[model samples]
Target chain A: MPAGDAFTPDQLYDIERAVRYAEETSGLHFSVYVGGADSETRPFAIELLNELDDPDRTVLVYVDPAGRRLEIVIGELAKRQLSDSSAGLAALTMQTSFATGDLTGGLVTGVQQLGTHAHQPPMLHANDEAHKL
Target chain B: MIVELSGHSLLVFVGIPVLVIAVLTLLVFASSIANGPRYRPGLSWWAPPVWINGPTATKPDPANLPELPELTASTQAPGATATATGVARTLGGASASW
Candidate 1:
């Protein structure tokens, strides 16, 4: 934590890097919302997702530090890339860090995990020339 | 032999070491000092919201946007369109608490 923002500039850089890596790995838009929810978080997060450019291809991570709640919302198309079980595992990783008062660490690791899970490697031998080997 | 020092000599010898110790202490705690408060569970948080990797392009406000009734109230209507986009959608997600 810093004077102005919740994180230091270095921490912000780390978080942004994690977000960028996640997006690059998964080919899905990733967004993180950190704050208090006006009311229930899930619906509010869905509303936030709908506000995105492509709601169907996005993953939104909502963290309520004050309320100590974390919600991960995967868009329809994004869900195909990122499974609910994977999201749950990421959430577990974040929860452990967050419970220890490590917000920045939690976010970075969780988002990174999500992105890794969503990654799809190219088919190894889908080419006609591969049979020649 | 016993040695006696003047007040100025004591200031030079004793005060300088004290000053050095103070500076060293400050340097050691500099990072923690720079980073003000830390988030501890069960304690109230005071920072504002931070959105990372958010939308590069903004859209019209919700007031101006059309809504699909199903998404508006999932429990209210069971037979309405299954998604906000008027198509059936399967969403994957997780939730947790600190």
Candidate 2:
């Protein structure tokens, strides 16, 4: 890893895998940002969220290690699938890990939980010709 | 009378034990050393920001992000900037601190 990089190659791989899992499970874009905020953490997080290709369908996880803050910003459409309460549950999980200085573990678990909460089960009968008729 | 210590006896008693302790210490710390620095609460962060699965288009610097305008009931559509578009109105999630 570079001197200025936050995670090692293996660690980054884990996070990216979790992100992929979340996207597949929830059918939504997932993004993660790890750094310090220029201003207040919440609005900065919102700003980061808006920077995505599909902001309305993206879930942005912003973690400020130096500030010891974590913000989970879900877009309008995504909010329907992932409730604020569910986001809170994930935040709580991340918070516990962060408090113990486990950034990678927290992010992996929290993103996974978010994806699971927003998971949409397949409709068994929807694909049937009889149902289409 | 007390026996005087010889050079070989000193090496066996002291040098071997010191070597064993040094090896043991290295073994205990090897993993963390390889892993590099870790994030600790309230400490100054060292690395640059990392964005995974972020926008394909290059984004403006966070430090230079335009000042957010006052939120209104009217929701603006997401444009290129999407900066002025108020997330407070539609954004929902959670906040936490350690």
Candidate 3:
């Protein structure tokens, strides 16, 4: 790890893997941002969410370590699948980890939880013909 | 009463113990040293902002973004609306602070 780097390569790998898993499971684009905010954290996070290619179906996790703030911004389409309550639960999980100075842990666990909560199970036979009598 | 401390005794009691303590201290701090600085709440952050799976991997200057139209009910459409800047009118999620 470099002197000012926020995460070691291994830690970054873990976080990326967790994000990938979340995206794969939930079928929603997942993004993570960690650092200081130039302005208010919420608006900063919203700006980040707007930067995504598919903002309507993306989830942006913004962490302002210096400000001790965490903002999980869900896109318009994503909100339907991942409700505010579920996001709140995930936020609680992250808050616990972050309070202990474990940024990576918080991100990984929170993302995983979000993915799980947002997961939509395949509806089998929905498109199939009726069964023979 | 004056007690004479032999060189051999000094090596066993002082030198060896100091060496052991030094090794233990290194072992305890080695992980943190390798990891560089860890994040502590309310402390100034050192690393540049990171955006994984964003529009660009590098952080963009907030000032560089074109000013967006102020969000207002009159500006909104019938149902869901996204501004020309792609800022969504409906946003859902939770906020927390440690």
Off by over 4 Å in 1: A1-3, A124-133, B1-5, B9-17, B34-36, B61-89
Clashing residue pairs in candidate 1 (N, C-alpha, C atoms within 3 angstroms): none
lDDT of 2 by residue, A1-133 (tens): 2246799898999999999999999999999999889999998998888878888899999999988999999988898899999999999999999999899999999999999999999889998888896
Model 3 scores what on Cα lDDT? 0.87
- Quote the positional error of residue B60 for candidate 2 in Å: 11
Listed per model, the TM-scores of chain A against the true chain A are 0.90, 0.92, 0.94
Per-residue CA lDDT of candidate 1, range A5-98, in tens? Answer: 7887888899999999999998999999998898898877877777778878999999998889999999888988899999999999999999
Ten residues in a row with the worst lDDT in model 1 chain A? A1-10
lDDT of 2 by residue, B1-98 (tens): 99888999999998999999999999999998898777777778879999999889886665676567765445554321245543343678999999
Clashing pairs in 3: none
Best by lDDT: 2
Question: Which candidate do you rate higher for lDDT, 2 or 3?
Answer: 2
In candidate 3 the C-alpha lDDT for residue A133 amounts to 36
Displacement of the residue A54 alpha carbon in candidate 2, Å: 0.5
- Model 3, span B1-98: residue lDDT tens: 99899999999989999999999999999998887678777677778887877785555665688898676767665544464554546888899999
TM-score of each: 0.80, 0.82, 0.82
